[model samples]
Target: MTKLLVTGAAGQLGRAVLNHLLETSKVSPGDIVAASRDTSKLADLAAKGVETRKADFTDEAGLAAAFAGIDRVLIISTDDLATPGNRLKQHKTAVAAATKAGVKHILYTSMPNPDKSLVSFAPDHLGTEEAIKATGIAYTILRNAWYDDNYLMSMPHNLETGTWYTAYGAGKVSNISRDDCARAAAAALANPPAGSTTLTLTGSESLNAEEIAALVSKASGKQLNVVHVTDEQLAGGLTSAGLPDFLVKMLVSADANIRAGNFDLVTSDFEKLTGSKPQPLSGYLANNKDALLSAH
Candidate 1:
């Protein structure tokens, strides 16, 4: 069995990737190492017989030790939205650790169209991708599209006020579920393809802001309204939402990129890798509708 090391094990995507690997792939629990900053948070995974390690991206020595004896490592992008450059350091640490431990394959989850793509948080991902390329290890880059779960917080607000706000204008986004992304990651982790490959994991179709509003309205039985705003207003709103200045700027910039048609198409890359078509927006709405409706 190929040993796989998964970073960010406590996160939603990481958990789903491990679960999918257990259910759908040939990887055994004994061959998996789940790493996180908080080892206590991974007690359940440990109980399942998988080796659990505390590997901090900031701590290179620990990472190198944990990566020992692993064949592949999945580098889940860090969540420090305010500091994009910091994650690059973390990724570099992990890369060096993998190199030291002689790991042959490394899977990285990155943002789609990250090369001067103008998306919020694209620079860090693009930089990390470059670093991974420099590492000389075989790499598989899953350039994940916008996640459907991003709507979760907005769903409650939209349902409550019957208004959905965005800076996307008429630009389309092939939003994908974090679960499908996880499945794709699991598939890649189980079998890291030859060479450095980049795949854009997207949904089955593309939907603009207005189309999503319509779908959300049907799912929630609400009079949903689509309100397109300027990036300035978006930055202000994010600031009011208590986001740091850096994050507010990042989000506004991403909206600008969306309006520029950066994330505006459907891709079959997910299906090509997973052997199954990605989920539809309606399916996500239906499955998550109850929670969205109840939230406020």
Candidate 2:
């Protein structure tokens, strides 16, 4: 039995991947290890007989110990991307540890079109990809596109205000559900192909900002208008709305990418991996209607 370990197992995506591996793939709990900074958060998984280990990205000794006796490992990208170079440092540490541990196969969660993306943190992911390549480990790089669930944050405000602020203009985004991304990751881990590979997991369809707003309007039965603005204007508005400076910059950069058609690519890689169709934006909105409607 291959000992599969998933880092950041306490996080949203990480938990989803582990659950899919167990419930969907029907893998034995004893064969999987859940590694997180706080193992207490993974008590439920521990109760299920899945091993839980504490591993801090900044602590090399702890990572080495946690990675021991693991045949395959998945390094979910850290969430602290706001501080420049902090995330890259964490990823490098993990990659080095995995290589040193002689792990047969390594997986990484990455953003789509990182090399050419305009998103502020794209460089960090691209650099991590380079580091993984340098290690010469059999690798699987999953370039996940934007998650439709992210809209829950901005959509609530847009719905309440009756105005959808965006800089995307007519540019479309192939936004995949985070759940689907996790499922694909689980599938890859369950049956990794020989040698290294790169896959871009994207939504089934490309929808522009206006079309997305239309979906929200249909779901909520409210009148919402897409108010196109310049990236500078959008950043200014978000900053005025009390958003952190780093987040404001990140959102503006993502909009700039959308406007430049950087996120417009729609691919079948997700279906090819999971053997199922990716959920459409409308369906996602409908499923989470109540939560979105009541989000403060």
Candidate 3:
């Protein structure tokens, strides 16, 4: 049986990957290992017959042991915003462990344009990607696009304020659904390409702030007003909306880059990887219309 180890299994992307892997494949759940900092959190995965393990990446021994008999390792980017350096260190440890265990492939979920991105979390991804490449293992890099739901979180706040303010003013983003990213990951894990593959996954089309405003207007029936604000205003807005200081700075800078058109490009790489184009944003909205409406 082929054994696949998935780190950060408790996170959204990790959970989505595991769910799709279990639901859509002939591969038995037992052949997959779902690991995280806390084993108890993954009880549902364990109950589904997935081999569950408690492998905190900070603990070198635990990480090394976790890769034993693993055929492929999917390192979902860690979510420690407080100290991303620690997470990158953890990724390095996991890569070493996978290498020692003779794992055939290493898959990573990384940000697009990691090297040049002004995204606050770019360095962690770029460093980890560099490490993975240096390992000489057969690898695949999934440069996931912006998640559409990121806008949904601020819906209530942005609507209440009567302004959908962001530094990504008129910056077109080919945003794809997180579920599509999950499906792409599953496809890669199921039938991984032989050498290193770097995929820039994006939506079917690019959309600017105006397009997004129009969609919001249609989706929620709100006389929602769109305001293209400065990076400073966006930073302040984010703070007012409950973002932490560090994140506010980071995101504001990213929005600046967005204005520069860094994240405006569209790509067919995801379809090439998954053998199908991603589901459209409209479909995502329609499927989750009830949830979106309930937010109001």
Measured by TM-score, the strongest candidate is: 2
TM-score-wise, the better of 1 and 3 is 1
lDDT per residue for candidate 3 within 1-296, as digits (tens), equals 78988888888888888988888644589889998888888998888899988888777777878888888889898877776478788788888888887889999999789888878788888999999999999999999888876767766556556677777776887788888898888778877877888988888988887787677666766657778889878887788868889788777877776777877878888877777888777666656655555555
lDDT tens per residue, model 2, 168-261: 9889899999999999999889888679988999998898988899999988777789999999899999999999998998999999998899
- Candidate 2: the clashing residue pairs are none
The total number of steric clashes, by the backbone 3 Å criterion, in model 2 comes to 0
Q: Write the per-residue lDDT of candidate 1 for residues 196-223, one digit (tens) a residue.
A: 7989998878888888888888888787
lDDT of 1: 0.86
Which of 1 and 3 is ahead in lDDT? 1
In model 1, state the lDDT of residue 95.
84
Worst 10 residues of 3 by lDDT: 287-296
How are the candidates ranked when ordered by TM-score, highest leading? 2, 1, 3
**Alpha-carbon deviation at 233 in model 1, angstroms:** 1.9
